[model samples]
Target: MKFWQRLFTAFLQRFHLMRFFGRNRSFKELHQSSYAQEISKNLSKRLLNASRTQTNDLLKQFDTHLTGLTEEQAHTQQMTVGLNEVTHEKPLTWWQHLWYCYRNPFNILLSLLALIAFFTDDLTGSTIISVMVILSTLLRYWQEAKSNQAADALKAMVSNTATVLRHQVSAEDLELMHERYGIDTKNQTTHQFEIPIQYLVPGDVILLSAGDMIPADCRILSAKDLFVSQAAMTGESMPVEKFPLQKNLEETSALELDNIVFMGTNIVSGSAQAVVLSTGIQTYFGALAHQCYGY
Candidate 1:
């Protein structure tokens, strides 16, 4: 019975019928599906409680430590969760924008009137109406195109890199380090490296300083006088202070948790180390971006 079930599932998947059956969705399809929003909500629930959990427990939940994840572990997680980058909706092409402008009801009515005038041999009226429609459509298209260009320019100004602690294990010296410390060598061999923010994965220990952007949703492992600006996420003009979780502090909202910081916020003062909790569309900022820009 199990064999037959597997065979039937394979058959449905092979012909791309699994989506109709609500099964066997590919990673991309799963994220793009209607259920994506629900999945993000579930993740949000989990992260909200993370600040109440102890530092050691939180690290254990993600299978990481203050020393950070091993290179192999990072790669595996990256494969499962995808790159830590927000995806924007594709902008309309020039022709598509022109078509959109021409599709306006007023423009359509004017076009129809121009055609009728031509058929009636009113050359002067037809020419004037045709010119009006062309000018209006062209003007709207140009304005929209220029606005898109400005948006693209602003997007380019966002930070694209982050500093993360990653463990490097050399097979040749692994045995020596383990023998000397009587512990795992991987956890003792972490080094801070600047990497592209898109390469970040959950469990990465991020290093933050004043003027640095928060690369992902993360829980503060430790901090010193850390002040972050939440103006990007919340309209609050004042910078909020953050610290490591000392006890199970209760909060009405995730943003109220002093131990957890969200993606896209900026650090205004001090330094800290944090572990990435979620990335890409699973983040609070990412979900908002998805809603605004679409998948």
Candidate 2:
């Protein structure tokens, strides 16, 4: 019986068995490798706040070296760049195509054979094979369409634009906090310096609430009746409580990060903003998706 089971399994794989079984025997990825694990693990790193002096120094460097903006007024202008564009497309490799071609090559070949056999009036083995070939073509096309739809949905999550603060006060300004926390040294004044959505990297904090897709991976800084669904990364069935990152970390017995959702997790119930810890393919879902697709 075991030998027959093995033989049947081989037969199904050889003839693109999953296609024949319809949805019964779908190809599922079981695991991911360490290389992919590393991509997900070191997803985000926070940049240390530059002191007012450091911000001034960095601003001067930016003006003199990168962009030639001499006026202090020019510094107030938004600085936005497409940092996450590199992870936009995952072009299929030649080997991936080769493997797919090998798996489904029979469909194309069968299509041709069916036409030939039909014309030649050769029904010996052609009848069943020809029907199988046509069915396989329909199945493959359907799968491709479904995959494209899922890809489009995933792209929609990150591609849509959102307002983000680009150059926030660097965390190093402790003394300045005693006086005026909002003063811009170069501007010689204080003003909200919100930049475009593109410049947002990991560790930048953003405010979020009901009906907002997370801009990046963030540990919950605070939550007001917060609830988040992490199905995109963890495949959890329901939304979990969103807790302050500090509280989540202190509970050593439980998964600290369990209640603390990452970037791309949807806020299901309440409202909160977290420090964006990861972005682009560095996101938990992004990294996991990368691994799953590679397999």
Candidate 3:
């Protein structure tokens, strides 16, 4: 990087990394926070760069096992990484939605008609029109509020989650995760559980089966004839088969490797347990989405 580029890079990492040190930032709230598309790829490039190793060694780097993170760790990573969803314009309140419905020319004309009726000494006619306008406004507001609520809920739940194994999480991080996300920290045993896509962090051992969405950028650990549909990201209608990588197998980029599974792709056949390395806007599909949608 040139001097200016280096300076700008330092400036960003300072602000971006600071949020993890502060209160948990809302991915829902922060659109540019990840800047996975702009501030240079943080998580994706690491795994891509590290793909020169065997899958086994790759798992070691993330401190993951076949089982998954205890609930605490998953939730903690959720806080750090933000939710896995597209950033949208701030949602409208009930009144705001109502106002939007009423702003049209028809609504304005109707309201004016009601006012004219009132001033013309037609009390019954004015009352009817006023009632109609008020009722319509209330109904419009109710419908819009419900629609927005449903859409918001859907957005929060849209990210396809993954199954992961927990292992070797630190005491401080575990405790912090427990305190922040209310996980079951009492039991010392670490096992597997379903983890949402957005909360995924490096080193999570993710289990995959046929028909499951690959939640993050991952290195294949174990595979049983695993085939994935990369149509959304790669635009290939055919499902591509994959396997665990061995040492000395070189690839210029992680995406070029057969042992890697990317986000937004679906497993078409068999199963696997891969170590998650990159998620959210850090996945291959995320990068594509960022470029196409500018989200």
RMSD of candidate 3 to the true fold? 10.7
What's the TM for model 2?
Answer: 0.45
Worst 10 residues of 1 by lDDT: 23-32
Per-residue CA lDDT of model 1 for 194-270, tens digit only, reads 56788788999999999999989999988999999987766679999998973445554566678889899999999
Give the lDDT of residue 50 in candidate 1. Answer: 86
Tell how far residue 134 is off in model 1, in angstroms.
Answer: 3.8
lDDT of 1 at 58: 87
Quantify all predictions' global Cα lDDT against the true fold.
0.78, 0.49, 0.66
State in Å the error of residue 142, model 1. Answer: 6.2
Which candidate number has the best lDDT?
Answer: 1
Predictions ranked by TM-score, top down?
1, 3, 2
RMSD of 1: 12.3
Clashes of each: 0, 4, 7
Q: After superposition, how far is residue 146 of candidate 2 from its true place, in Å?
A: 16
Q: Please provide, for model 3 over 234-253, each residue's C-alpha lDDT reduced to its tens digit, 9 standing for 90 to 100.
A: 55679988888634465544
Model 1 steric clash pairs: none
Query: Could you tell me the lDDT of residue 51 within candidate 1?
Result: 77
